[model samples]
Target: MNGPDILASLRANLAQQVQHYISPIPAPLDVSPWLAMALLQKAIRRGHHPFALQAAATLLQLSPDKLWRRAVSIAFEDIGIADLEIVSLVTASLAGKAFRAKIGGEWLVASYLVERMCLAPKCRSADDLLMLSERHPAYEHLRLGLTYGTIPELLALVRSNAPLPKRALALWYAVGSDRCPSPQLRTRKGAPQTVFDDLCEAGHPHTLVEVAREGFRRSGQVLCPFVVLLASQKSEQPAFIEDDDFPPETMCGSLPSWALDVYSREGQQALRRFLGRNCDTARWVRSHVPPVQRIKFLGDILFAVEGGLLRNHYRWPLADELRRSWAIECQGPFCPDAGEIMSMLRIDIQLLNEERQHV
Candidate 1:
């Protein structure tokens, strides 16, 4: 297809894909970055770099600040309460003139859609909040609320706030922004009075102002005033905020606790049965597998478990053991020069785990 026709086709495809994946408000075309990128990509793919640059400029027609502001708006509005990283990255890239590739901008936009659809963590951040506030006053209130409040309080404010812009602001602030009171504080004891928790509990709008001020004292952050403003504007209870650190097992949707409990019981039984059935084979495999291979296999198995993925779980002990063993194993003359074989075994284990999860 010619440039214009290719652009139109790509735009239509992107709109359909985005809507299919995200069901964004006010149709996908209203936020033109995706389309602009698509047009740019088409130009570049056809070896038309000069035309691509002109097309991109004509399509955005935005000052750097305006483009960034619009990008943030799209990031929060369409991507919504999902990942903030893509939004943050895109905004930063645009602001800093870092994404100069012909297809780089479009790739970034497409990546956001893909990540959102896949339910991965969207790395949006507090920087997006600051940018939105500077560009749009309506968004400033929402950003203020989120910056100051805890996750729960932010959720409550968003649900009851009026005016689509106000509600959008709340989503922008609460979900899109990624500021938190440090991962260390997450484990602290006692029902601490977080801006989030306070918003969740406050009975009156006036209470939010005082709470917001107090939140600033406690957190020493600048987002408190906006949190107080959102709380003051709304007067209804909101849904419970999804606890951030709740085990991923709870959020996977496909694996219910009961099913996992049953799976755990059955998995144990299956392991025992296989062991009994293949005791001879298991021993033979173990004996035949080199020491390095065995150690590597054990490490691979540990990583396969969901709990093992946590930093505290695997980093220190497993890493230390691997390093110590690697020194000894590499020095030995009879270390079963099966490097390719061991590599294949690790790959096989990973593939097996992936297949099991799919089943």
Candidate 2:
């Protein structure tokens, strides 16, 4: 089926599922839409259905647009190859507030998706590869060349037997950097439609391709198509779905500890207070990182440890490599002492969390 037909069929087939889906989850009365988004993704990643549903409800009330956008992104970014059907369901949910109202109402549809995603198998390889393609020093020359390659040439390269990440770079360039802008990459106009059609021609699965197309159309992220490309070659391989280690969890006032991550205003203040203390974590950051980059540096480590903690770890050749790259290159080089620093932070973070709750 073509893109529209595929979505249409999904909408028809999943209508009953959404209509009957029910959750008693209540929106946290005080969560800011920003924290709600942060909580939603992490909750989904951790397979915490209650928190995911609550955050989804809160975000739906506060910012339905961002809620839907976040849903589509996690579908590609976290749940990519593990469950393409769920990805497609989330993609179909992007049909706007009205369609949702008809099929199951906004909250029902949103809650249904959050619950399913929490239970679905997880794979973050697509977003991991996208990050590597852009940031890893090895791709510096490849990035420059692909950024300027002609649409036809880039399209051909996408189908070539090049390395996976390199081919992803070519596919992104073909999709047009202008459409999927990255401050890190030189931007050019891309033929996103042609790129999607070409993937179909290249024998990639239709559901994945269509989800990628609609996902990119909605999110404007290159990770969408990368999910299709990454899954195309690995779907048949021996795959493992194991329970990942749980990230340390603590409560900060009314919200989960993660909601106070460096991005949140509260999280920043807590980190500031945490850093101000006469502690080894503070001393290490002070000596190793510049004064200006300390909070961000620490935040990156915090993310490595706590954020994006996938509860359902999907293992395949490419997915495993991406996980290793994430450990070694993605976060390893930037913060070599991440483990040591995290141990230090754990000791005093509670002190800051307690203080923030009072504030």
Candidate 3:
């Protein structure tokens, strides 16, 4: 199969309302539960959600309780701070009857599991620490606490063993303090809420916008007003403006840009005009709609692109533009300038040429 041709075809069909790409559900293998579960873990770790989902479903068919337990374990061990929401989401799925019920219930569970796992950022620090705690003499208490006690219980044990390993303790605090919504486990109090909660509390509607703003603050970059307004909506508990009102003039400012050199004079003017139109639309949306309804219209584009699922579903021109903008801004505050970009391009070309010669 030609790679470029495949990409072109995929992009061409991106605008279609229906899904053209359907991955085959995995068939069950006559393997041990441990081995099959291991394979499922590998697929999920590699972000092969389609394969992982199918494999998990096959495993679940063999033993639902076991597979559900394994999924919960993987959530805490493998996926840590990279995605704080996965544990709760997986816990919800485990308790959910949707996985066992007929009439598309099984598929619904599989879809939810796979999409969340695939979209979440992967990290294994918690996994590594858990492994070390099993053998390390100093971590014996920590290991026992993890095995038999709640997160806070484990933290209390580790806190007493402070001089053992500060880094490991920090990792435990970071991952363990997250709220676990599973009904089966002992709930810990004063745990850090979900990222969405934090963002919502701080008055930012969009996750990427909050991330981008933090990136700019760390790197001394300017944030565009349009992106800011697009990130924030009419706040529910507002102190300054009315809950329904939007301040258009206050929202137009500079956005972080790496392509600004290329977008000089007329380019900047054209971009501003484009932003202006968007700003007007945003203002209209805020004024006409309730705060609850306005968030989806303003923030869904960034979230969709961040998860890489929106591109697969919608090919609206505006969505495409937002994807491109996200691609640029999501690189954090300091993007590579033209010269650095050209250098990387040259390196890539050189490697491609070398591969071709060898072939």
Top candidate, metric lDDT: 2
**How much does candidate 1 score in TM-score?**
0.20
Residue-level lDDT tens digits of model 2 in 78-105: 9988898899899988888888889868
- Pairs with steric clashes in candidate 2: 175-190, 176-190
Q: What value does the lDDT take at residue 188 in candidate 1?
A: 22
Q: What are the models' TM-scores? A: 0.20, 0.92, 0.35
Q: What is the lDDT of residue 237 in candidate 1?
A: 28
Best by TM-score: 2
By how many angstroms RMSD does model 1 differ from the true structure?
A: 21.4
Clashing pairs in 3: 223-254, 224-254, 224-255, 225-253
Candidate 2 scores a C-alpha RMSD against the true structure in Å of 2.3
Q: Residue 67 error for model 3, in Å? A: 1.8
> What's the residue-level lDDT of 15 in candidate 3?
20
Candidates by TM-score, descending order: 2, 3, 1
Residue 228: error of model 2 in Å?
0.3
**Comparing 1 and 3 by lDDT, which wins?**
3
The lDDT of model 2 is: 0.80
